[model samples]
Target: MKFIAEIDVMPLKEILDPQGKAVKLGLGNLGIQSVEDVRVGRHIQLHLEAADEASAKSIVEEACKQLLVNRIVESYTYYLAEFVLSN
Candidate 1:
């Protein structure tokens, strides 16, 4: 079976997001005052083969913990689904 994982990685809430702040400041300079407290993060999509949903989920979770996210400074969340043929 094939599975798809949609993942989100983000800086920890306690960690300051300098990039987000810079973008927010830039937006303010552009007269976009409505936007504030902006935060930046990454999205990742993965397709892989697995025996079942449980196996797929375990693989994705391990990947996130071991490689995708920095446990100390960043966190990750993911959604997994079985791949289906539309045609």
Candidate 2:
């Protein structure tokens, strides 16, 4: 079966996010004061083939733990779904 994984990687709340802070400052300069805070992160989409959802989930989790996520300063969340072919 084919699967798609939607992953999000973000800095831990205790970690300082300079990029997010910079963007927030920029927004304020642009008169967007309504923004209380900002947190910037990456979104990734992966298309994978596996025997089933359980297998696909295992692959994705391993990938995240081994490479995608930084355990010390970052955390990740993912959503998995079966892929459907369109006519």
Q: TM-score: which candidate is best?
A: 2
Q: What's the lDDT for candidate 1?
A: 0.93
Root-mean-square deviation of every model? 1.0, 0.8
- Tens digits of per-residue lDDT, candidate 2, 2-73, equal 999999999999999999999999999999999998999888899999999999999999999998888899
- What 10-residue stretch in candidate 2 is worst by lDDT? 67-76
For residue 71, model 2's alpha carbon misses the true position, in angstroms, by: 1.1
- TM-score for each prediction? 0.93, 0.96
In model 1, the clashing pairs are: none
lDDT of 1 by residue, 1-87 (tens): 999999999999999999899999999999999985998999999999999999999999989998899989998888999999786
Cα displacement (Å) at residue 52, model 2: 0.3
How far off is residue 36 in model 1, in Å? 1.9
Checking candidate 2 for backbone clashes, the offending pairs are: none
